[model samples]
Target: MKAAWYGENGGPEVLHYGDIPDPEVGPKTVLVRVEWISIEGGDLLNRIHAAPSSDHHIPGYQAAGIVEAVGNEVTRFKAGDRVVAFDWNGSHAEFFAVPEHYAYPVPEGMDLRQASIVPIAFGTAHDALFEYGGLKAGEFVLVQGAAGGVGLSAVQLAARAGAQVIGTASGEARLDRIRPLGLEHGIDYRNEDIAARCREITGGKGVDLVLDLAGGKGKDLLVKALRPHGRYSVIGAAEGTLPSFDFFELIRKAMQVTGISFGRDMHTPRVHQLLEDLFADVASGALVLPIEREFRLSEVREAHEFVATQHPFGRVVMRP
Candidate 1:
């Protein structure tokens, strides 16, 4: 099968697209003919930081495709079923072989392109907001880097759940785009002070929850924006600079910081039910995950580079 892989960690330029051995499907595995692969933030982070398990390591996590083969033990699906699959790697290829537990059946009427982007982004946001963050209706929630995939998902979910959603984007144009999706307040992080705006928006009471997707220098501002004992959901670090909370800082506010890893729960009944509902929402036009850009598998380097530098609104997809 054709794949984009690398022998070592580096930038998008390190990726090489060519022929690679087809993954062998095991007893509990499902082989999917890849249609769309979502370029997640973890993909870039893994390319630059995570060690490769093999000499030729394919990097990606989420993809939607048709099931070409199913394992002997697999009872949920069979050949000709459309599904979205997730794994720590091997999604950047023509055929993705994953355990049946990691595969979610796409809704009957949804496009493969849209189903490909759902699980990770929506699951991560759902867990961060409700499962870990303990968000309540009428509370104020601030989503940093709100224009990205997970960020947009958080804004929409929080807003729909009745939380006052304050989102941070690079500019007015991007912020304007998501307002209809349920952003109650927009903060142009480039030109506005997030903490100040949050304080003002909440009438001197800081936000009840802060979803920090951009984990660089902006972290302090998010910390300041949170009210005492507020929940801080650490989901991703788009800027690549992770911040550590000091002992004094934690004590001063009695804040709760939770790190979200959606993959950990992908096989659980809770997440399975969550994805089922999410898939239905997208298929029925109740929820939306926009495709900011699309590329072919051969342009792997350019696609990864565009995701890192272009500040894509939702997700960047690749066809194989």
Candidate 2:
């Protein structure tokens, strides 16, 4: 199998594409011929040693592919099945092996390239909004970094659930892309104060839920934009700073704060259920994964470089 891997953690230059040993499938694993792999910030972090590191690591978590072979113990799928899998490394190769439980069947008629984007960004958005935040219809939701991967998914998911969605972006072009995804209001954080704009949009009641992916004093900003008993979910920190706030504010407003980290053990039946729901939405033409760009496997380094420099409107995928 051909793969792009790093023997040591450093920069994008460390990624080298060449022949690597094919993954040996375990009894509980399934071998997939990867069609498309989504490049995420987490993958970049792992490559640069900002996140977890492993020697000779192949970095990629979400992929859409066809099941080429199955293990003896695997019962959920067989050869030729089109599927999407989440949280699997080594997807930066022609073939990869993943546990059967982590794989989900892609609905018929859905583009595999688009379906590839759902496992991480869309899954995280669904888990944060419904499972963690307990979002209700007719409520107000605000998504920070709305132009990025998970942020765009959150915007659409929140809107699909009947919540009025507000988003924050850095420029007008990015905001314009977010508008058709059901964003009712957009704040240009570079030109305007996010908290103030959000407060004005809600008429001072604040939003019922706040998804803060850009950390900093944004925690305090979310607090200001959150209504009483609001739910605040922290998913990422692209802004590079941490802020402090008074504990009394939380007690007074009865607000809830949660930090979400993705891992192997986080899988549950509810996650499977949400994936099913999201796929159904996609099948009905209600949900779509906007592919901002695509790169070949050999251009993996360039893909990471692009994502690092420019904040794209949707996901960047690599066809391996």
RMSD per prediction, one decimal? Answer: 0.9, 2.4
Please give the TM-score that candidate 1 achieves against the real structure. 0.98
Clashing pairs in 2: none
Candidate 2 deviant stretches above 4 angstroms? 7-11, 48-53, 240-254, 262-266
How far off is residue 223 in model 1, in Å? 0.5
What's the lDDT of the predicted structure labeled candidate 1? 0.93
Model 2, 1-320: lDDT tens digits are 88888877767788889887898999998899999998876677667644434556778887899999999999989999999876557788888788888888998898888788876787788777887788999988989888888898899989988999999998988899889998999988788877788889999888988888777766677788898988888877656455555779879889888777655333677778778887888778787767789999999889888887777778899987
In angstroms, the error of model 1 at 103 is 0.4
lDDT of 1 by residue, 145-217 (tens): 8899998899889988999999999999999998999999999999999999999999999999999998889
Backbone clash numbers for all candidates listed: 0, 0
Tell me the TM-score of model 2.
Answer: 0.90
Candidate 1: which stretches are off by over 4 Å?
Answer: none
**lDDT of candidate 2?**
0.82
Against the unseen true structure, what C-alpha lDDT does each candidate score? 0.93, 0.82
C-alpha root-mean-square deviation, candidate 1: 0.9
